[model samples]
Target: MSGATILMLVVGAIAIAAAARRYNLPSPLVLVVAGLALSFVPQIPNIELNPDLVLFGVLPPLLFNASLDSSYLNLRANVRAVALLSVGLVLFTTVVVGAVAFWVMGPSLGWPLALVLGAVVSPPDAVATTAIARNLKLPRKSLTILGGESLLNDATALTAYRVALLAAVGSGVSVVHGFALFGMAVGVGVAVGLILGAAAAWLLCKLSDSLVEVAIFLILPFGAYALAEHFEGSGVLAVVTAGILIGRKMPKMHYATRLQGGSVTATIDFVLETLVFGLIGLQLPSIIASVHDRSAAQVTLLVIAVTLTVLIARIVWMFPATYGPRKFSKRIRERDPAPSKAVIGVLAWAGMRGVVTLAAAYALPLTMDNGQELKGRDLVLLCAFVVVIATLLLQGLTLPWLIRRINLPVDEDQADALAEAQAAQQAAQAAVDRLEEIAEAELPTGSTIVDDLRTSAESRANAAWERLGPQDESRLETPSELYRRLRRDMLHQERTVYIQERDSGRIDDEVLRRVQRELDLEEAMLDR
Candidate 1:
């Protein structure tokens, strides 16, 4: 149907997901099933999406936003494991998959093309795995490894895919050249991202208006990606690099900047995720059409082979690759943290494919360089669909159960403590800044209210600072819980007043904007 129909489907799916969550079911699985059922309805028109729009338009910003939200400093602290998994592990899986697919399904395609297909599906989607991983109580190191691997492996897989595709298209490709290109792509992308990220942050700092700061955040990802891709570097890598740079600097941001910026970014990410999932669901019909000609037995075999290939490849790579470097020296073991077996198992199972894989596969040209209609293109699409469905539904659904069965408990107490301490520090700092501003402005001598406000704010600041104590303390007490409760009540009252004022036309647009930002910040802080 129209774009409105697509919007409705997404809304309906979100409602179902909420219901499913309340019932302790996997919301993603519910969404997938609902999407499938909706797709079969004759009245719902098939979606014809531009691959460029999905990849360039949708993927870059999503990648950037995810990067921005992640803690780059923490990610860097565990860089070794992340690198091993993202680059080394991805290559290992691709080789295993390529070899197996060639051996088992070569009758469907030639070796080169089958290898290309294997490379295509190798990278795990960070977005999907992180969702499930976040729900589980895994070790911090393990979470880092999983999240880091998901974020970086896309660049690696994409590089390999490009080489493989070019070779398949009769472009001459040397092993040395391919390796050089891969290295160059990553190097260039990272360099570009860092430069642009720093520049964007500098601009945001100078720009006082919250909306302008938000707009800068929005533009950086696309701008970085386009510029990198134009220069023959990896856009995915560029987006991620920019994100990491920005994220590392986020804590240093001013309170107003952090609040408004985070609010805007979260809104964008939520909307983007909804659109991405809905678009993914909308592709099912075309996938079905591709596999329509295959016999049940053949379809079943292809599905099983691809499924097992993905499953086994991860297991094979994770165990030895994780432990191998440790054997060289105890120093390495000391330097590098290891993932718990249960966490490893959960990560292995969390390899759900999503928008990136689908976009890449569907983006395949209709013909090869030889002007021949692409053979087995439909089969590749079918297998990719099967993998996406199986992983998103089966593994995604069972992941929480596996984590619990293995007794992997997450320690969010640490997170809460850190958040509280940070909040108190920020609030105190904001108060100090406000007091300085009031002093500089030289308020009227008779204004007792301003003096009273200043004294109260300064008192609160001093109280917060005393409670925080020494920086070395493992735990610091905070008035944050009480503060949060009071703030929530304050927001509720303000919201009620704002609604009344708006209805009575007593507040202007500027007033509404200011109040809206306050409400948005209060809601976000309360969310978890």
Candidate 2:
């Protein structure tokens, strides 16, 4: 890509994404649509998604960000569902899709090539699924299942893709060998991830500076991916492992680091996801150009047949995957009860594919073992493109409607507010105890400072408790809300004076920045 195109891609994506957010539209879907619309413009440059750049450069951070935002607690709670979707479901989809492709598309896409296509599209896009989940505000359990499934499913799909590739390239792979390869990838990937996650946690703990700590956090994902890949493990799993470990460790770190880390990661996700979907759309012209060998009728038939199969296959798998284990295995029945059918139906519909399938299609070997161009190479890319577009357009657009119609049994937001109140009350009590202990040991008992700290803690806790009380406009402001309102005005005045001091040359820019940060933190707390 040229500099102009790069600039256009970044700027266009950001602007489009911003608009999407303003309109409450799915940014990924909008970006993809924008890119597709832009692709036909002769004045616009042809945008090529380099397979290596995407897999190595693009995939790791996106995977890591998804995992980082995920809840380790929620994941552990729904491990069975996650595993069923990530491992069992991905393999099942591959076999089902591959068989159907071979049977329907004829010898043009033989068993090996058919399996390649299957593996490419087997896993739903992690980036896409999580984005939809957060936007839809699905129940906690449903969100956890979707997030966890997306987080781990890429590893399964990619591993299967490699095994299929080995067969496709005439490396003479057998079923036993393929299973062994998959096993090795999973084992090694997890091991590398755990070791790296521990090391990253150590490094994060040692560094107090939020800036440097976040920088290290930024570097670790790519490093974990590369290191794991170097050892012949699944890079996807390695990055995910590191993310979950780091995420769980985050609560122990300084709040400043947590605040800064959250902002940094959110920004990175926005930029990367916007660019990814935009690229997905822009490749329409090139992807279509590559499929000169296939007739229009043939391409249409394949696209329609495979797209329907991919959608239906997930719906078919969810029933057995949800109930089969609980019926047969006492462990699953005891630990993890089956989710409602409505929830399972939502999960079945959330299978929109994205960048991974596209990148993997391009990652196919350029030539066969005999040194001739690989058969059906363009066909695979075309199939991947069509499936991605179709699923994203069909499923992504209608998912929200489906959720509303099904109405999964989620408790309202009041449940979250009540939980916060309970935690806050306990925290306040802890603070009071600590203050009393210190006062007895060092300061005279009932010192004004101790009294003030105790009151502050109580006020913070009571504000939370007040959320459970009357919230109508007719109600008076609680002590905490009143303090927040008046204090915010005072903070604004303090910031104005600081800026004036800087403008009058009484305080240097550095001093002004330091003072402004303090005021900003106070204001942010009030806003929260």
Candidate 3:
């Protein structure tokens, strides 16, 4: 594609995403629809989907950012569910879908080709799952499990796909050998991720400039992914582990670095997600054109069968995965209560596939070992694309409605607020203690700065308590509230003066911006 074409595609995608958000629609769905429409335009270039670019270039950052934003604590608590879905369900779906595909398209497609198609469509897209769950505000545990599964499941599906591909290419891979390879890939991936994560954390600590720190983070995911893949490890798991490790260490970094990193990752995630979904849509023309040998009825039947198998396989596995352990183990019941049926229903319905499926399908080698065309390559690609579109459009669109219909218990917003308030109070108290120690050790007489520090800490602690406690009736307004109002008013006045100076040509635009930034920072502090 030309540079101008790429630029135009990006601009169009951004506009579609913005419209999706404005109408409270899923951006992935809208982007895909828009791309499908654009695919028919005569002036538009036939942009080829590079599997390597999507996998190596795109997958790492998306995985990293999702892992970074995920709650490590929640993930730990839900490890059992995550493992069941990410590993057990992925493998199970591969077998079920593959078996069915082989049964339906046997003699011509063969078992190996069937398995390859199965693996391609087995795992749900991490990006799509996370985006939908967050937007719809599903149960916390559901979101955590989905997020955790999405982070790691790609490795499982891709490994299975690789093993199946070897067999399809007539390499004669055994089941035992495949399992051994899977284990090695996982063990090595985790080890590499830990090492790289620690090294990145150390480097980030040594750097002080916020911009430089953010820049290092932008490179960390790709570095981890490339290093792992070089050693034949699972790049997906490597990126995910590195992200989680670094995310846990973010608290130790400067607040400016944290703020800047968040903004950068959010922007990267938004742009990549838009492009990916749009690219999926844009492949429609090519995919349709490639199915020249198969009759339209055969194609339609294969697509429908494959799509249904993927969806049904997830549902069939989830029930046992959800309740089977609790039924047998007393300890499991006591420690980890099973989620309600409604939650499980929502989980089952949320298996929408996205870019990863298409990337894997496209990554299939065009020719087998004998140099003849790989059997069913087009069929597999078409099947994978159909599965993606089916789930994403069918399940993604209906998921929000399902959640609402189920009326699953809402998240505990009040309890969460209380917890945050309590944590803030503790932090404030620690600061006050530190200030007292400094005053006692450094100066014979306490400085005014010490008094101001104590006052500020106390005010913050009191405000946190106010969030939890009843209003004080004796006073018209709390002292902290009054102080915040006065500070905000003062900052507003400063901003007005800066604007006036800039408008009157008394100050340069740059100077006005600098002054305005300081006021904005102050206002943010007051609001917090």
Give the best candidate by TM-score.
Answer: 2
For 1-528, candidate 2 gives per-residue lDDT tens digits of 777877778898999999999998889899999989999899988777888877887788888887877899889988888999999999998988888788777887789989999999899998878766687858888888888888899999999999999888888999999999999898889988899998988888777899988888889888988988898899999999999998888877777788998899888888888888999999898898898767888788787777888899999999998999899999989888788888888889999999889999988988989897788888889889989998888899999999888777778578888999999999999989998888899998558998899989998888898877666668688767888999988998888888898999999999998888888888888888
Per-candidate TM-scores read 0.84, 0.96, 0.94
**Candidate 3 structure lDDT:** 0.88
Score candidate 2 by TM-score against the native: 0.96
- Model 3 misplaced regions, further than 4 Å: 441-448, 468-490, 503-505, 526-528
What's the C-alpha lDDT at position 334 in model 3? 98
Which residue pairs show collisions in model 3? none
* Superior candidate under TM-score, 1 versus 2: 2
Residue-level lDDT of model 3, residues 1-528, one tens digit each, is: 677876787788888999999997889988888888988998877777889988988899999989888899999999999999999999999988889888777767889889889899999999888776777867788889989999999999998999999999889889999999898889889998999999988878777899999988899889888988888889899999999998888888878888789889999999988888889888887888778878788778888899999999999999998899999999999999888989999999999999999999999999999898997899998998889988999998999999889898975776876887889889998998888888899956858888888888888878877766457688766777888898888888888888898999999999987887778778877777
Local error of candidate 3 at 324, Å?
A: 0.8
Identify the runs in model 1 with alpha carbons over 4 angstroms from their true place: 1-26, 412-528
Superposition-based RMSD of candidate 2 using all C-alpha atoms, in angstroms = 1.8
The window of 10 residues in a row where model 1 has the poorest summed lDDT is 463-472
As for candidate 2, its clashing pairs are none
The digit string of per-residue lDDT tens for model 1 on 1-528 reads 466976776687667766777897655566667777778888877874456876788778778877887776678797877898889877877777777777766666666667677777788877677555666777776777787888889889888888877777677888998998898889888889989988887776666777777778888889998988888788888889988888877766666777777778766665556556656666788888776877778667776887788878888778787778888779988876666677777767778877777777887777889898777677777777777777887788787778778887777666755666567667866876877688668866657776677666665554445443544465443454456677788888888888789879998878888988869766775554
